[model samples]
Target: MSIASSAFLATIPSPDRGVWEIGPFSLRAYALCIIVGIVVAIWLGERRWQARGGTKGTIIDIAVWAAPMGLIGGRLYHVITDNQLYFGEGRDPVRALYIWEGGLGIWGAIALGAVGAWIACRRRGIPLPAVADAVAPGIVIAQAVGRLGNYFNQELYGGPTDLPWGLEIYRRVSPDNPAVEDPLGGVAINDVPVEVVHPTFLYELLWNLGVALLIIWLDRRLRLGHGRVFALYVAGYTAGRFWIEIMRTDPANEILGQRVNVWVSVLVFLGAVVYFVLARAKGPREEPETLRSPDDPDYPDSGDGGAAGSPSGTAESDTAESGTAASGDGDAGTGDAEAGGPATRPGSASSDVDTGDDGAATENTASTENTASAESAPAAGDPGAGGPPEKPGSST
Candidate 1:
């Protein structure tokens, strides 16, 4: 192939359509991408939470609240920021509710979605920070996946470019009515070129994936807790979004000659940084045992009768065994005294029995010692015994 032709061929082409009609229903690619992203995030979050000693299905439980609230928050942010699109003289306000058409703000989603998560966490008696830390990487990966929706919708592109990898922007119109332009709900009609532009959405998707990996690596290495991992994720994401947001040619609200999102990115990044630094006082990653609240069904009780397989439970079992052995020794010692024979200590079979004048006293003393040994066995077996009580974990 000729060099010019090869270069042109290498350019990325936009999808001809972002929606499909199946029977009487219209399925939107943007909505499918969002749903897929949510599923992936939940799946990954559950695994990560379990790895961090959280109960299974906790992520799903939290998502029941977070997901819906997040969607609402994202849509609200988009509408309020770009009010001109819906509330202008010729625009229709009802279209603001059409989320499938695309437009969600990460900042607002995180802000309000956190409120929902906080409610679920409180109800479950789990620390919100712990859950946030566990799901940090998953959230970033979900964002990356969601960016595919923007690409299919033929939005969020940057200024025109001649680069070999530049994205080809197609002129789309309604299939049934060619005169009516429907950028988000139309099909490309010709093979002729209009203009190739910088694929900003692709750039963001790649960046988000890189951030997810970075967060995972840093979290594993540092054993981040107290929401430090989440803070790191926010900082990392905002850093990338700041630059990517600047590259987009899409119409958006601006503040002080710069896009409002750029300002939001700067503010959010600083907030994340501050939180990450302050969280150091919380010490290292929490012990799995300490993460659960006493009210949690899965919590290990350390009372007189502890939960099965717990340290206190093990100690109690060991104590019972020790007491049984002591009782057997006591019976043997009594039998020897009654038969006018020398009494031997337990586990001292080879040694000569006590036949001295103090024989009765020795048997009594040995019996007392055996009782003491039984009492001390539990303490020896349980490492946490007599230590300070464990404090219950709390959330912000």
Candidate 2:
């Protein structure tokens, strides 16, 4: 085909390169996309987590562990299930570990990521189901963003199409063996002058976005909790994956004549549906745990589910605020402790006593008897102040 003919097709073109080098470091579009997706997930998760009474750092901290585990799980699932691609007679087994080349199973990632998250949640004394419910929508949004990596990799696209929205795949050639045909097709697409295929990645991306919106909307409207929201997310995502996986023309393992992923999606969707239904009977919504960072004053710590005040002992802690703290009054004036202790007011510190009975010095003590007697005493000029002046004669 002529260059003018190719230009007339007007299709989305794949990136010329998926990786670039700067200094000694190599940056890969696929890896960058995953990293950005994880970051977005963590940011959004943090908001939802806070709404659920979780602390600020919980989402990021859990992600730190979940991301690597998910990556490993995804790669493990891909290599193990699709071993033929890398472990085939002529293929190099080492390439199986080349995750930057783009092959991650969402099912495996979620499963393993949840395990990692559970560990983090356990350490923080948080329930895993609660955390799962909060982050469900954000997780799907991250998956949506991850599809961009497939776009750059020029992989996981659908069959040939002539539509205006088709994705233009560059000529795929077998460098090691020119005789080898493209795994996606029986024929050598490299010989073809031009190849335009359906942009299945975009299809899945849009679907994931829709799923994310649906999960969020349902979560808010239904007040879904106790992991039901997470179940809904699983169901919604698998529903989309079932259809999208069918559209993809990439090389995938087949089981019972259909893609193994399609079966997995069906199984997963059923599990999610059952869980969502059963969870409804358990409760409508989870009580957001009032338990949060004990140190974070701004974070909520009350079980009341309202604007939280101070820590757990806040109301009770006012005991000290109401009055000056009780301590031995050592000195006549301030009673402040010197190097040894409060500068003793003569014999006062010996047994919680006060040297002088003037209401001034006695007030420093925690004693009830002295405080009451001092209060009863009247001024010198008052009737009761002199205590019957003639009574002094009888006592003498």
Candidate 3:
């Protein structure tokens, strides 16, 4: 056999599936890794949420809004970037919404998912930066899982290498495919048509997970806030992506044999660096916005006051001023009518006169007090005298 044959022989993947068939379905490592990654992301996010002084319910609230958005965003990203794959002959772009078939771009997912999370956080009255920080590590871990998905799909591999740790091609991509190879000169393997590339997916997975662990550990020890850890995550993951992009043999339009993602990684890494520098220079401080107490007048007690009833019961309390019961009674039908009656209205003729600290001074009493005075004195027999008043006179 020729040297090319020997090289090709070394690059076959070791089929290592436990081969457990659950009835009619098959569970693969790729699916398992992705699921585990999502679970881990949620766990990490919840922990970070609490650390940032968020309510326990915040995670559930956020997930309710974010999960679907992220998934949809990710699918959309995949469809747009690889439009030909989904829009080609006999293909239904609508089916592109089907995520179970599995095509997601990390960048697209992150970008759109971040928006979803921001809206959710805003709705929950949580600070956006704090939410961003909580999500940072999880995103990295999720990317790690996503890379494993690439491995299962047998795509996104790199150039050939003789290294002991080099990935073997369980499945090879065609050079004719624009996605797997660039339009170029002839290159054959083992005197046969084959393109065995590096397993870039696994490399990315391990690196991202490693970076995530590092960020999490450092966050606990350092107590960095304002998404510093997350910024570091972006920086670190981009750094790894940069390195892997160099080794990637996937069909890509490369400027100087470096893929477009390589340049993107550089730009992203620089951004992350700038962010980290600014964050450190500013000296990490807790965002004042996140520091809200239950008693805070402006603090949102529950769902937007647009709900049927405000949780603070301010509406009910205000109603109490109108003769309604001030207690926690839930009744409103008979109570309102009774409370509105003259019998319940204070200072009314039928009710006890309202007295201040001084004394009761009703409308009539006030008018009488204004008229009476010492100067205008009435004599004892003023009625028979025909004079209204006399100065110090008691005789008639």
Candidate 4:
């Protein structure tokens, strides 16, 4: 191993626990880290949501729904995994609900939190998959900080190895057995020896940090489909956890002498691959048309589907003008010569058609109008003798 790695492994310094002790109640580093992570994630998500042309209040609206669900999911995961410790032997199972004591599962948090977020997005009409992509990197980074909390507790370490990087474990007398001292100075149990194990928490912290960086880099460089980056995160973390679980003495189940987490890693990795492939086949999700700036002359305003400069308004105006002129000409043509004589006609006393012949023409037009009125009758108040309502909405 390199010098830095050797030093990190040989003597990993236990991080200091920054606590605020107010009488009996004590605030801890773990809680603070989680809160900071959540705040930062929400801020970032909000900024991205606005940048993407989403509604003004979408982020805050969604967070109101998603936050509580995430907390519940995280606690539920811990309870399910370590039920034996919480529920058995006269233990108050209600204490399991006390999340301040630090019991949360990342898997459950992500899964159920996603459900909550999805619901929120649906309510707001925001695209759920796109929001997932925006939040993925932030979630991984928060997880990295959470791991440091584990470090302060001096928990979640791995197996022993003389690689000059092994964390020292100072042995202590157990409450039940006060007559044993381990070589590595671990807490003794019934006069038995137990050495200090590896710090898996630190390993996970560093791993998650690296993964977070990788995700940010990929997102910036490539236009990945929605939810793909989050899938990769799941697969990546699961793979790392699988390896670390092998080196640790945790009571997580095993399959074929290997930790059950290993199989989970494999399955998650495969799932990521499958999800990406299917998503590509289905094509990209349709995005809504983004409106230009309000100040732009081309921007749509009240009572219009498009900008004033657009062709729709102009076309409608032109059609109205033409229709009005056509209707007026038709009306004039049906009148007698005395009202408005036609300038051209054979056998006329004046250059215009004779009033008698014009009257006869008017009578014929009135008869024809009554016959065709069945098909194109005007609305309520009968004004002109039968023609389509002088082309309604036409400008005079």
| Every candidate's lDDT | 0.78, 0.70, 0.59, 0.58
For 295-380, candidate 2 gives per-residue lDDT tens digits of: 45555433333233443334423322221224211222233311212222223443553334233443345466554443444322
Question: Roughly what TM-score does model 3 have, to 2 decimal places?
Answer: 0.60
Q: Between prediction 2 and prediction 4, which has the larger TM-score?
A: 2
Q: Least lDDT summed over 10 consecutive residues: which range in candidate 2?
A: 387-396
- Distance from true location, Cα of 244 in model 4, Å: 2.1
Task: Give lDDT for model 2.
Answer: 0.70
Ranking by TM-score: 1, 2, 4, 3
Residue range 1-396, candidate 1, lDDT tens digits: 665445569799899889998888989999998999999989999998888887888899999999999999999999999999999799999999999999998888888999999999998878899999887888888899899999889999999898888998888999889999989999988644478899999999999999999989998888999999999999999999999999999999999999999999999999999999999999988767655555556676533333433423355443333222223223433333333433343345333333333544443244665446333322211222233222122110
Per-model TM values vs. the true structure: 0.78, 0.70, 0.60, 0.64
| Order of candidate numbers by lDDT, starting with the best | 1, 2, 3, 4
Candidate 4 local accuracy as lDDT? 0.58
lDDT over C-alpha atoms for residue 121 of model 4: 73
Error of 2 at 391 (Å): 52
Global lDDT of model 3: 0.59
Q: Model 1 scores what on Cα lDDT?
A: 0.78
For model 3, residues 1-396, the per-residue Cα lDDT tens digits are 777556656555523221234677855555566677777788878877766666665665676677667777877867776676668789887877656446676667677777887887776656666777787898798888767666655567778766555565432333346246311111122233245556778788899889988988988888887768878898999999988878877555556766666887898889988987787875665643253334445443323322112333345323332223222122221222222211112232332232222343333233443225211222222222124422221111
Best by lDDT: 1
